[model samples]
Target chain A: MRSRRTVDVPTLVREAREGSPRALGRLLTLVENAAPELREIMAALAPHTGRARIVGLTGSPGVGKSTSTSMLVSVLRRRDLRVGVLAVDPSSPFSGGALLGDRIRLVEHALDPQVYIRSMASRGHLGGLAWTTPQAIRVLDAAGCDVILVETVGVGQSEVEIAGLADTTIVLLAPGMGDGVQAAKAGILEIGDVFVVNKADREGAPATVRELRHMISLGDRTEPHLWRPPVLTTIADRGEGGDEVLEALDSHWAWLQEHGQLEERRRARAAGEVQALALEQLRSRMGSPTEGVLREVVDEVLAGRLDPYAAADRVVADLA
Target chain B: MRSRRTVDVPTLVREAREGSPRALGRLLTLVENAAPELREIMAALAPHTGRARIVGLTGSPGVGKSTSTSMLVSVLRRRDLRVGVLAVDPSSPFSGGALLGDRIRLVEHALDPQVYIRSMASRGHLGGLAWTTPQAIRVLDAAGCDVILVETVGVGQSEVEIAGLADTTIVLLAPGMGDGVQAAKAGILEIGDVFVVNKADREGAPATVRELRHMISLGDRTEPHLWRPPVLTTIADRGEGGDEVLEALDSHWAWLQEHGQLEERRRARAAGEVQALALEQLRSRMGSPTEGVLREVVDEVLAGRLDPYAAADRVVADLA
Candidate 1:
């Protein structure tokens, strides 16, 4: 039954840590597919995680998130920090085939030995990014990345989900018309640890920055001991203002550590991870509602012989 | 302990069924708040549900969804069918306060006793639209609306979610630059029961329609016995094609009935609703991870003393 790809999980993990991008890629492919071997791979990677600093960058589609990610990557390379970029398209599962288009702009460091870049779509059917991204981060982390940058596409619940995963979450914006209100509308304002107004060359960059700061102050971030998010501007396409962006990220990282919030965030992430897995286990045990006790309850609920809450109560009691 | 607003649940349901919009609005407010009375309200409303046909209209911003919904409401009203329009903004909770802006275009129906229009936001903390929208639909259905139109704002996952909730789903598009490719990219191609090119008077209407038809054929909808989604043109702002859209909707509804898909989709929806409620119950029983058996398992997972799957198994065992 052994094949060329079945190269043993421990050996693959060792190779990944020894700077073999092919081995790392193979491991990530397993994660993406939700392979049966993941239990083994995660057990192997578990002891080696918790070192890389995970930073998440999110914005609306037209905002320069990809370009800003490139700018940040080059900056991290300059500092001799090993970088891992995971560009996640929460909206589309077909994006795995289109990585060449996504990565063409980052060809500057495509050959850099210290830079490990990959793009992961939610795969649509394989659970969700909330479940898979953290595991992928673990893959990159155990592979010896000093900093991991997660760039998520689209907005709404995905941004909130990304914020929960990252130690430092960056919300990006541009100088487009009504972009400030646009940011507020997407609920990104509440989740960001740092705010970046990209396209500084545009007419309304400063206005956007001012508006963001005012909005932050007006919110409950004014409470003492809580980190007040900083608004910075960048022309990411030209790689201008990248160092300042890096500086702001480093400052936030430092604040998280000093306030002992890093451990708190990581613990919260671990809790969420465990909770999702536990729920998945319970769901599988309940079996598909296509048949079994779950199906009977659903039928009863449909007939109005039982309320959904009562059906749920019955299912939980049966589970016990 | 009963406040003035604490009108008894069964009486409220009765009043709502007897053409009382006030009673209906109060029931929906209960849904938005996840009120303690919801279990009672849902039990009371369950028998009267499943009679109304729920059609979901969704598209990206500026695609004239609200306008199109208004046009459809007029058609439904002309037939003397009681109409309920629920405009759900899945992206923000603050949208409840801005109903005036959303409803201004629908001022023609402001005085109609038979037409009920309500805007529901996810309210951020109130579970999610998936868990709460069904209850709201039941409120509309039990109140004796013959046709319920659900218009969702934004796109991506929300479109898929609306598709799951509706008996038939209409996806709208505008004739603009790259609008055809935009439809393919958003993953909405798979979910539409009927496709609409809303701004048919615009520059690229014919091309967009052609592009959409070609894309539909390329997809999995060509299977025998499957309903092929029709691409139609409408000048919704002028209300030019409302009757054709209504015809298309009626045809799709008839097809669903003939194929028995209406019953299948409702069963699937009921199963999902019950599944979500069961998971919520289990999560509450597990309690907070701040301190509990769950906290211990999370700590173990963080320390790499236990893999996530193993921790999950331990937690599930503890639940039993």
Candidate 2:
């Protein structure tokens, strides 16, 4: 493969596999930019990806998503497992990019070869998942990381979208942040595969936990898959109770594997790759010269001069 | 115009203008479904649209957006101004169409001839504003409405995109919805032209307002046109202080008009129409025969045989 002197994909991939921080950084940038050889590189790397246990973290802003992720990464690194983090930042309206200052919160991990952290800008994707997210995850997974954690952009709907993308989703809630119970009512309570009462040291902690436990108990018990999604309490900044968090992760992974759900999830993720490629291909093809015929069909449909179904059929025939 | 047996666009538009509830209901459905000739019909109806002051209500779910918009509409109706409401809802994940049930909360306007309401689905667009929105605005705008209110889906970057569309964007905030200040810190806070401390009857109302005011005060003060935006208090559910909300709206609109910014804003909105058409055309062109060239490009790119820019240029060249 043709490679630039400054950014060699093979060298970067190899170094990242060997736990080189700078190489990991370069690899992440290539993935985010959707580099020329992204698909081929990612395809080559897919076999290595299924090994990493993916964790999804989500909550409203200032509920300490970055801080909690940092502590969790530290705990994973301490266990001697290499970790990769993908933190998704909400985009800025003026700049059309993410204000990712949250990355600075994890500066402690900068020198730790075992930990690789990358910030991803949401880039106006509707679902909380970034448009490039699944590809980014594949890149991290192929780079030989033990665990890959994805942090959502902290809006309720985005939290739900991110939950769907991960094997285990943690919905973070804080005490005294106002409307803790209301947030639960608005869909966060339903999407969480695991609930984290973050900043547990704050006032109203017990009440929030008690309320959450009560809510969880009230939920229908029709789908128990070995481990019940637990409500864990932690003061993330102090690195307290992170071990319990790890236990929860391991238990959830084990539960999925024991139930054969892991394979199901992997199948779904693989299917997503096909859909992404189809969408990309579809978008690119829409602008071709042959599009003149389709443009006439659309104009006629909009003008009531042509039937929509008939137009669709004609286009399909033309494709054939 | 060739008229349908059950619903005729011109009749519906004319009757809806005369404060007919059934006519408004039928018209909204036509627009939301993006009925044929909508663009032409809307352009024909633009003059009547100038009467209503459009206000955009947005925030994440659980922030009381519907309640706030309902209250604001109620307050406007009390002043005898005809009000039209558009609530944008998430399209069904499975069906790829919007579930209009989100508007169930705002049915208080159902029997009022002075108020018209419609719900739009984003149809899997992710966070970008739906294609049907502006036309729906035009249909309501033309049918002799006094004020048009657009309520966003309140998820992810939608709040910011919606802000750009509305004449006056009022971002609603509830006291207890997690990270009181930080929720406003991301893309949401930056785009809001005006802030609504919704659920002001709640305990943390004063603090939320103070915090918002502080942030507004600290922002760049050089653009007097973008002066410290106002933060208003409202118990939207109870219809309390909504008159003050309208007063703020009046003042904000007057400010834009006095400085000749109103015309500029309208001009930008006009330009938005052409951009929207392009996007709509793009969606329609997908899956058509013209996509053959795009498929070839993708094949080349996927095989790591062609650069993305080169592929993109080839497609653009065909269009030329």
Candidate 3:
């Protein structure tokens, strides 16, 4: 059952920790596939992950996600911090093959040893995090990367899911993307820990930012936090005002810590991680021996000899 | 710990069956809450649910979901069938109120007893289906109803989940959403058994239908079935061309029958319904004695006393 291209867990973990690009690439593949050896790899490098501040950048397609991500990387590196970027793209609708074009726009930083970038796609997986994105972040985090930026295709639900995976969630909006703000109403707007009004050089930037601030204010009138998520305006292509964006994020993080929201968010995230791991294991175990017992109950339900709900209860009871 | 006001489950079930709206309303409320008595009530009503052809109608907002549903009700009544519509709306972001606005737009059959419309919101339930929506559908489906339509707030994931609850899924789309035929990428497009090009009086009507047809052709290249999803055009607001839409649907349904897809779809839908029920029960059971067993393992995980993967193995082993 062994595959020819096996992952070298220990060596890859060591190299990834030493900032080896090849090692990081291999580890991301392992994580994306949910390979059986993922735990061994992650455990070997867990010490390095806590150092990275994971920032998720998401917005509608035309809102300049990659540009903002690049700007953030440029700004963080100016402070002498190592930055890693994971830009997620949607696979081709017809071919099912991904076009890793996000990294092409960020190719200017390819020569910088302090910067690392990887582009990932949904890979036909449903439950949120691009299968490899989280693993890649763990690898980069363990590699002593000071900052990790996750850029997601911002078509709402997936974007919100990606945003949830990060320590700091940045929802980007651009001027003239009118429908973009309305689309945010679904669930994305609620997930924004920090909002970025990117492409601030354009018209209606002030109005768009004001509108968002007003909406947030209206959402929670009686809450104590009174936190109007700062809308930092930036022209990412020009690298103008990138420092202020980082400063605003730092301020938000500090405020969250002071309010104890940071601990609560982390706890919820850990719970989600645990649940996801449980579900993944459960899905794989569907073909295991226990499932044979469950199938017998299902057969009874199918034959109309027993109620489906009662049958399910019996199966779970048997498992218990 | 019991409340003073206990429910009369049998009487409510009897009244609900006898066309008493108040009793039906009360029953729906209980189901929405998934009260302790839910299992007994549903078991009593299970025999009544098999007759209705439950259809789930979904798409992005402004694609005329409510209007299309109104047209559908009109078509069903013309054929002398009793119809019920359930509109699932999420709570208002600010006020925790139901918009219920989907009902107002369906003006054509407002006076028909054959057409019953109900609106339910998330009401703090975590799963996509408004807890009341499915339960209400079951009640209506059992009460000699011929067709049941479930319309979800066009915001993405909830609608897809609604499709799983429906016997046949109709995905509505407008001509110029500017989604660039990436329209089908949202996972909703993939699940559509029938596609409707509403607002077909618009300029891009033919082109959009052609685009969709192309997508469908690409999807079914490998598997040849007698049932091909035909594209239909409609101007639903004025009820213009509603008959043609119905014709296309009938043909599609007949094709499904001929190709055996109809029975397959129903069997799959039933399985999904049962699984969703099981997941809901498991979710509600969280923090119970069942969860108390897992909590200890989770605590060990958070404390770093045990790794998550190892803990998952133990939990599964314990469950087995």
Query: A125, model 1: CA deviation in Å?
Result: 5.8
Worst 10 residues of 3 chain A by lDDT: A90-99
By lDDT, the better pick of 1 and 3 is 1
Clashing pairs in 1: none
Give stretches of model 2 more than 4 Å off.
A1-7, A91-100, A103-105, A126-130, A224-227, A288-320, B1-82, B87-112, B117-128, B131-147, B153-156, B163-320
- Best by TM-score, which number? 1
Q: What would the DockQ be for model 1? A: 0.52
Specify the CAPRI tier of model 3: incorrect
What overall lDDT goes with each candidate model? 0.83, 0.67, 0.69
The predicted structure with the larger TM-score, 2 or 3, is 3
Tens digit per residue, CA lDDT, model 2, A2-93:
46555555776677677677776666666656577665565455445567788999887788888889889988988999888888764432
Q: Interface RMSD in Å per candidate, to 1 decimal?
A: 2.5, 9.5, 5.2
Q: What's the best-to-worst order under TM-score?
A: 1, 3, 2
The chain B TM-scores of all candidates, as shown, are 0.95, 0.87, 0.87
| lDDT string, candidate 1, B34-53, tens digits | 78898899889888887899
Deviation (Å) of B200 in candidate 2:
18
Question: Where does model 2 sit among the CAPRI classes?
Answer: incorrect
